[model samples]
Target: MQPSKLRKRIGGEDDDGRHARFLQIGVPRGVLRCRRGPMDSANDSVEKKHRKVLSDLAWAMHKLPPKTYSLSVEDGAQDAFCDWAEAYWEKADQPTTKPLLAALYNKLPDHATKLSGTLHLVNEYDPDNSDQWHPSKTIPLSVIRLALAIIDCLVVEAERFHANTDDLEAQAIARFKELPPVEWTWDKFKAKCKDPIRKEGSKLWTNVVTAMRDAGIGEVTKSKPLTFRRHTDVDGHRKMSA
Candidate 1:
């Protein structure tokens, strides 16, 4: 049976859930039995062996959260994976041309680095710009990885949805539009958090913002300002002048 079909039959959450059960069942016994000819059964056995090996490899990589383990961007390994994918496409000799992949591989890192530097430069000149501008350098490697995974998921999903290149590009633009505005200063970001519009129901955006804040992209203020007002006594009453 296909992995998906097996999961459905076992009434699990997803393929990973089913695989977890398979692991518990023990590797040797978890080997899939096929109701087919000897040759087919042998092939199935070989495939099962490889699958078990992969499962062991995944376990050795550390116990990641379901989100991370999921074949999705929430895993936070998207950026590195994207780098690997670009290299894979360059090396792999598939029948179809991968010009788009080539273009992305060439453009993304340079674009990210340039945009990050520009935002940093602008921050030094104008505090206002610094508040709303998030440079790409502030993005964590894990988060970038997750973002890349999400991108991959969207592409695969688009193919499943019978979407064309234009549709895919449009979707990418839409996703980018949804990302939170970048802020170079913590104080500026804190001000943003106080804005009624920003504080509204955006959990993921809030989390990313918080992560950036934690990473020192946005630092919290520590000390109160000292007052230097002059105090004058008039008719036995002390009055403070700003």
Candidate 2:
């Protein structure tokens, strides 16, 4: 009887080697004739397993939403990654599978750092209020710092202009990083923060001015009590006209 195609391809003229391979392995010669070579079967299986592992990791990343009060989505995502790594690390053969799982695990620390900073800002500032002036739920802390720096410049300019915040916004925006131009106003400033950062800024500004007065840093211009007006922008903005 003629040898099968797989056997002929591998064994070729080495008929002795072919019989030795066929007999050495317990798989019947008939079975070798009926099935694909072992190498081909193994390659296909590895490919399928590699794809499944990738798909599972992608799904886990997708499930992690933004963190919120009483819900640490960042923590949840970290746990998911840990679970995936533990489950697949032992089974991961470098042959067909990429080390993408390990790469993502490495990025976990960076993600945690940002989440921790945002949570601290939120908890410290808007402990009760839920408004746009709060730390943004979606915006990164770096961006928030940019906004705060811009505001500080504005306040400094406002003070320079004898507490008149009227037209100082445009000048401040021009000097700082150019965000898409919005009509400059105190209300607009509040809107930028989303709630947390703004609340914290307000608290800190008030506290500092009060502390300064207590320490007699600035003179009390208005009432009999040692009180200093932190803000002086007129109109609907948090302006205290002494």
Candidate 3:
């Protein structure tokens, strides 16, 4: 469960543009209007680029050995330089080799100030250039940290899914208990309720169904009336569906 690629559907053609119109007054400028206050965060084209980089990083992490994975680009470049020096420098004199080595070593960028430059140097040394020479652009530490945190969250969720499906079922039961007894569909429930469970976004239906099954609520049969029910005693042991 590496986070399901569940997409949400918007009703009309303006569905995609609706969010943009809400957050911005103009098209080209994309100026932040903040009609809905601080929650109306602005979206920019750079967000896609950042997402791609993080996806690449996560993919690379999956393939490589954890102990060998180096977040610091400079470290990888230094290792490459050492290997190159060992192989290429055969009969070079100490004076010539010393300066050559020093020059190569100095080329590694200062990590604290120039992370982008460090990544550039690493790209040059990498035969595969897996980052595709695009790391030259300065990416903020905040973005990188946020990406890592998301990855960590997904990995943890995956582990939990395997280990504690029962726990999730219990949680769903508990959440259902908090709400008034009602037949509910995810869409209707989310619109009417401000409960944290309903705000699960794209995976709301999946989660609700999973919890329903785990709690032995009922089977999901597809028909004209699409509904899920809470088996509560509120209406005298009667099942409620929505």
Candidate 4:
């Protein structure tokens, strides 16, 4: 059967990926357009261009393919991405709402993935076992390259199904890769990323606050305490863990 058309929804009720979420796979603005309302409507407002830029990053999270990037992503993963895009956009504070232009800018600089610089972007596998898993900040570039390759492959698959009817995942990928207006670069991956990358954190926080506020007079909110983890560091490697 033909791949099902990517569904397009609008207006997330402060829930996970809701509005326009189904189109998130690789459609432009699908991932970045999570913040609701006209002001956030397009993230193109003047005020939207005045936030901060995070200097470093560290990320770790496990995603079961079907759960991480597919239909149910809105249930969790999509919200996670939306949070990052929104948060990063505020920091990027640029006229456009796309966070990837800022988030991945440094990602492809010359020799960037090489062994240099104290600030590092590292990804670890088996994050639960100390012998097999734990956040590692100083892994060698050779190791990183392999990991990155795997990630690249996964990402390609992750967004493939979001391709248009006339487009196979490969065709879509190739077409989007060379989109005119300019040559492809880490900075201009905006087209390929399809939409603004979601801000990092807030969706869950917003839910919690909402729950607390809704409790009204004597809100007896009971849930795990929100824990804080720092993923950014100036003096050493900045890691990203989801």
Candidate 5:
């Protein structure tokens, strides 16, 4: 169910300088509703809820087609970031040990401003050099909530990969869709299309392939003409061959 691995074909080949372009999507807040459960302790319940929402979001991204979006480096870094953030806060003796990201989904603050306030402390977070977070810790909302500083990093980095990705794709697909139908093997389609399809934007091949797939262009198979032959045998009986 975890689809982060599913990005391999489209977003996986990050080795040769071709990194994934993280697509920016606004997940509906309604979709993020928490699944209710019994709480063991104070902050433990908060973390449990947050973790569930994270899982749902990850699943949503996974259920999308391989061509739907590209992976960002920040996609899977949530846990480490939270732990590291908490470790940093620990030394400072902040009123609460629970990272802001550890907040319940409904209570989780704005993604931007809350993160900006504490990012300067990320370097100080080394678990080997610091104490770790425990599941049973009690954190009340009354304390100053200095949250998951790294998720701010994720959302911030998330901003980088989406420079007109959607617009460019819509344009490319619109252009390709207008072309006259032809014998549309991939190579043939490329030869017929220009720029985005032919050369310019080949780095995102899925977009190009998607255009063709959705546009419904391809060669149709035709039946060959049937032929029959007759030969006389020595017994004077005729037999037909196809």
Candidate 6:
């Protein structure tokens, strides 16, 4: 008896140019055959698994500290951590929930310590506030600072781990680093405005300078030197302006 021909389904048609179908070889003795499925389910399953692993790895790396180390989170760890963070934030502001708040508060100091200055900003600005203060309008400058620190730490960690973080995350880290630390003193503020090396013309600087001017600190000006500098002599010595 001749061996049965192995036929494959291709483009809704069979190898022999007819609609796909199962083939059977029969002999007076015995024979058997089977048809292939319309889709490659096994390949699809493998691809899905690969994507899940990559996503989990990326999330885990993002939560890690920016230091050289071999650490990994278990499957579903990211989801669990997020759920816990949500629950913690939900109870943070309730006066009666002191115990719960205490537990979560303890965790933050360690995480904050591990983060860089920028990532700490993100953590502080994490909008899931349980307080009366609105996150949109009243988040503290310290919180913003901490949240930015946290983001910076995460990006550095991602690179250290060779995790595939998105471009947006990397860009955020870059932008945060570009921001200069706030200068509350009039002299420091004026120096910042005039510093060509610091890119002080950014929108962040513009907004901050505007706010200070509105509060009567002194407006930014190109026509004349900064108020703090107007009193300085041409030789870079301090003198009262006439």
TM-score for each model? 0.21, 0.15, 0.27, 0.20, 0.27, 0.16
Candidate closer to the true structure by lDDT (higher is better), 1 or 5: 5
The digit string of per-residue lDDT tens for model 4 on 1-242 reads: 23343322211122433321221234332124566555654555444433211111212232222221121242353344334335534644666523333333223221223322212223334333423433443444444344344434433443343322223323333333244432233333333443322121233233323332333311223334432211122212233479
In terms of lDDT, model 3 sits at: 0.42
- Give one digit per residue, the lDDT tens place, for model 2 in 1-242: 22233333533243333221121111221113465555687878999987875565445434445556232344453344345335434434445533332333233333434444444453444322323234434434443343334433433332222222212332332221232322232334445443433444443333333433443334345443323432222221233459
Query: Which should have the higher TM-score, number 4 or number 6?
Result: 4
Full-model lDDT, candidate 6: 0.37
Q: Per-residue alpha-carbon lDDT of model 1 for 1-242, expressed as tens digits? A: 53334434545233333222121111121237867645677888999987875565444323422221222244444456556567645643444634333333344443334333333333333333433433332434444444455445544442322213223333322332233533223333334343433333243233333333333333323323211111122221234579
Q: Which stretches of candidate 4 lie over 4 Å from their true place?
A: 1-137, 166-242
3 against 4, candidate with superior TM-score:
3
Off by over 4 Å in 5: 1-23, 26-162, 183-187, 193-205, 208-242
Across 26-55, the per-residue lDDT of candidate 3 in tens digits comes to 112123584564542245457766677667
Decide which is better by TM-score, 1 or 6: 1
Candidate closer to the true structure by TM-score (higher is better), 2 or 3 = 3
**What does candidate 5's lDDT look like per residue over 51-168, in tens digits?**
8765654454344333311112243334443445455345335554222212212122334223432232232233333234111122222111334444444543434333334445
In order, candidate lDDTs are 0.37, 0.37, 0.42, 0.32, 0.37, 0.37
Q: Which stretches of candidate 3 lie over 4 Å from their true place?
A: 1-172, 175-183, 223-226, 231-242
Residue 148 of model 5, lDDT score: 49
Candidate 1: residue pairs that collide = 68-75, 77-145, 78-145, 78-146, 79-145, 132-182, 133-182, 134-182
lDDT of 6 by residue, 140-241 (tens): 334434443554354344232222122223332233234343323333443434343234234334444433344343334542323211211122223356
Q: Which ten residues in a row have the lowest lDDT in candidate 3?
A: 1-10
